[model samples]
Target: MAEFIKIYPENPNDKEIHKVVEVLRKGGVIIYPSDTIYTLGCDITNYKAMERVAKIKKIKLEKNTFSIVCNDLSHLSDYTKPIETKTFKILKRSFPGPYTFVLPAVNNMPKAFKKRKTVGIRIPNNNITLEIIKQLGNPLVSTSIYDEDEVIEYTTDPELIYEKWERLVDVVVDGGYGGNIASTVVDLSETNPIVIREGKGSIEVL
Candidate 1:
């Protein structure tokens, strides 16, 4: 079973945070809360851990693209191609909230995105998730934690998430209840940004 750690959503405990970071540094996969929902994440550089996440999701890594959660825009350009002036302005206003931007990928990012030339990047506003990434000193390759039950839709309760995913993952950090909705996906690949999925984020900025 995975370790269950309860972290304050607004003011996380550093000691508990350390444990989470340690697991991640050792290439452990975790389920943590994001602004939109509970998410599965692991060290972006750990290919083995990345593969484990892909397996848990039941998706082919080559055919699927997972979003990388960065601390801020500073870590973005390193993984993604240069954003255009107009797109940059739009992203500046919407990020650090509940939006994910899909941009052309840079060569340096991990090989999981090997078949695709673009990557989805997110700078979630949630403090617990942000602090974990900041302490880890690198971005996390992440995907929302969900099941296919039509009645359930998405898993938001941390205890239930732990119950369902504990055997498959290493740890579960409960940052209280998470939103059932997902972050609004805005793809910036074309000349104009496209709203691929409208969920929690507002559409005005795009």
Candidate 2:
């Protein structure tokens, strides 16, 4: 059975937040709320935890690209190559919101999840999620809480999520229903930014 922890969506209890972080540190997969949607996350560096997330989603390791959730813009450099000044300006204005930028992965990135030397990175504005990342001091491997077929399962109730995917994931952090939407995806691997998918964030700002 998956352990479900209730956390304050805005200002999560410090004790509960610590417990959630402990689970991540131990390589446990957790379902947590993000600015855009609820996500399944684990320490990106933990190969076993990453594998568990992949297995639960029925995603082939070779076919799916995983995203890293950084606590802020400064953390982006840890996982991806340096962003150009112009691009950085644009990102600074729009990030900490619902947007994912695909950039070239840094050389030190873990090979288990790197694909074509690129990775998806984002810094969400959610408090609980951000606090957890800040405490961990590194990004977490994250993906939408959905099936491989691209079906989205959005809910705020922990019991509902537990009843549905209890066996699939290890833990559930019930921060409440994040509005049903995925992050806007931008491929910045090229000189020009391309909007691959438009979700919560508006394109006008990008």
Candidate 3:
């Protein structure tokens, strides 16, 4: 059975944060609330854990891509190449919200992202997720917790997720009902930002 943790979205308990970190450190996958939706995350550096999450989500490695959630811009350099000054300015104003930017992947990034030499990065404003990444000191390989048919799975109750994917995942963090909208995805690899998918964040800001 998966361990269920109830985290206060605004002020997560230290003990609960530690438990989530422990699961990630041990190569365990977790279902947690994000700024936009419920997501499945695993230590990006843990290849086995990443593969496990992919299997649980039924994501075909060839067709789907995953995003890496950094705690802040300081950690972005570790996974992706340096951004242009203009692009950096745009991200500065828009990030820490609900947006995912696709950038050229650094060589140090995991093979999963390196396979395409591009990575989607996010720096969410949520405290629970931010603290978890800060504690781990690395990005979490994450994707929306969508069903096999490509429907977003939004459940406020931890028991529901536990009932469905208990054996597949190691833990679930219940942070209340998520917004159920996805992050607005932007392709920053181009000279001009392209709105790939419209979600919670506004593309007009770009």
Candidate 4:
């Protein structure tokens, strides 16, 4: 069973945060809350953990790309190609909120992502997950967890998420209830930014 940790959304406990970071650092996959919904995440550098997540999602990583969650904008260039001035401004305005921007990726990505030409990046406003990413010293591979049932849509209750994903993951951080909606997805890989999916974020900033 996954270790369930209840963290205060407003004020996250450092010790609990460390526990989550440790798990990620040790190649453990976790189900955690974001500003939009509860997400499945693992250390971006952990190829095996990424494989585990891919297996759980029934996805082939080569065919599907996962959005990477960074604590802030400082390390975005590490994963993506050089950002143009306009793109930087747009990112500055849109990030630290519920938005995922798809940008041209660096050629030298992990083996699983070598075939991917673009990558989605997010810097969520949620504090607990941000702090966890900050301590982990790298981005986390983020993918929204969609429930199999149609009625619930996206699972919001942490306890229920744990119950459903406990055996499959290593940790489940209970950061109170999460939202059903996902982050707005904007494709910035082209000359013009396009709103691909309208969700929690407002397009006015774009």
Candidate 5:
């Protein structure tokens, strides 16, 4: 069963945060809260952990493209190619929020992201998530927690998520409530930014 760890929405506990990081380091998959919704995440460097996440989701991305959440813009160039001056300015203005920017991937990212030559980078505003990434010292490949039934759609409640995904995931970081929506995905790989999906995030910055 997954470990349900309740965390403060504004200030996550350091001890509990370290425990979450340790799980990821040991190749464990976890369901955690994000800026827009509850998300399932794992160590980006752990291929086996990522495979488990794919199985839990019961879906295979055609290009094997996964969204990786980072702590800040400083690590962007490590996974993706250098951004244009204009693109950097735009991202600087909009990131650390609910925006996912799809940019060209660096030649040496994880296999799943590198082959596609693109990566979806997120710098979520959620504190619990950012602390996890910071302590883990790497990015997390994450996706929204949802089910096949369109009636309920995304899972918003942490207790319910614990009940449903306990066997599938390792941990559930309950950081209060979530929005049952996803972040706005903006593909900045081209000359102009493109909106792939508009969810909880506003498009005013784009």
Candidate 6:
């Protein structure tokens, strides 16, 4: 069974944050809240945990296009190639919100994503997730937890998310109710910025 933890969105508890980070450091997968929705995440460096997440999501690791949620832009260049002036400007304007910018990958990423040409990057506006990433000291491998129901696109309630994903993940973080919408996906890998999916993040800056 997964460890169901309640973390306040406004002010996250350090003790609770430590618990989640410990789980992640130990190669455990977690269902945590993001700015837009409930997300499945693990430490990007943990290949075994990445494999577990891929299995739960029914995606092959080699063909995965999973996003990495960074705490800030400090280590952006470490995972991606040099950001062009225009692209950097856009990122500076839209980050710390619900936006996933697809950028060209660096020659050396984590082993699990070594062959990936591009990677999605996110710096969500949620405090709990940010604190968790801060404590973990690295970006998280993230993907939204989508619902199969005809009407609802993404799961909102944390308890329901926990119930559905308990057996599959090691931890389920209850950061209150999540949003039904996802992040706005922008492909900045090319010269012209392309809006792949329009969701919670506003397109005004893009």
> Which ranges in model 1 have alpha carbons more than 4 Å from their true place?
none
Q: For residues 1-206, what per-residue lDDT tens digits would candidate 6 score against the true structure? A: 99999989888999999999999999999999988988998999899999998898898998777899999999798899998899999999998999999999999999888888999999999999899999999899998788999999898989998789889999999999999989999999999999999999999998
TM-score of each: 0.97, 0.92, 0.92, 0.98, 0.95, 0.98
Report, for every candidate in turn, its global Cα lDDT versus the true structure.
0.89, 0.82, 0.84, 0.93, 0.87, 0.92
TM-score rank, highest first? 6, 4, 1, 5, 3, 2
Separately for all candidates shown, the number of backbone clashes (residues 3 or more apart, or on different chains) is 0, 1, 0, 0, 0, 0
Q: Which runs in model 5 stand beyond 4 Å of their true positions?
A: 60-63
Tens digits of per-residue lDDT, candidate 4, 1-206, equal: 89999999899999999999999999999999999999998999999999999999999877757898998999887889998889989999987999999999998988778898999999999999899999999999999899989797899999999999999999999999999999999999998899999999999997
Residue 17, candidate 6: C-alpha displacement in angstroms: 0.4
lDDT of 2 by residue, 56-171 (tens): 77887656677889888887777778878877877888888889988888888775665548888888889999999988877898888753334554664566777877787778
What candidate 3 gets wrong by more than 4 Å, as runs, is 60-64, 148-153
Q: When superposed on Cα atoms, how far off is each prediction in RMSD?
A: 1.1, 2.1, 2.0, 0.8, 1.4, 0.8
Count backbone overlaps in model 3.
0
TM-score for model 5? 0.95
Runs with alpha carbons beyond 4 Å of true place in candidate 2: 147-153
User: CA lDDT of 118 in candidate 3?
Assistant: 80
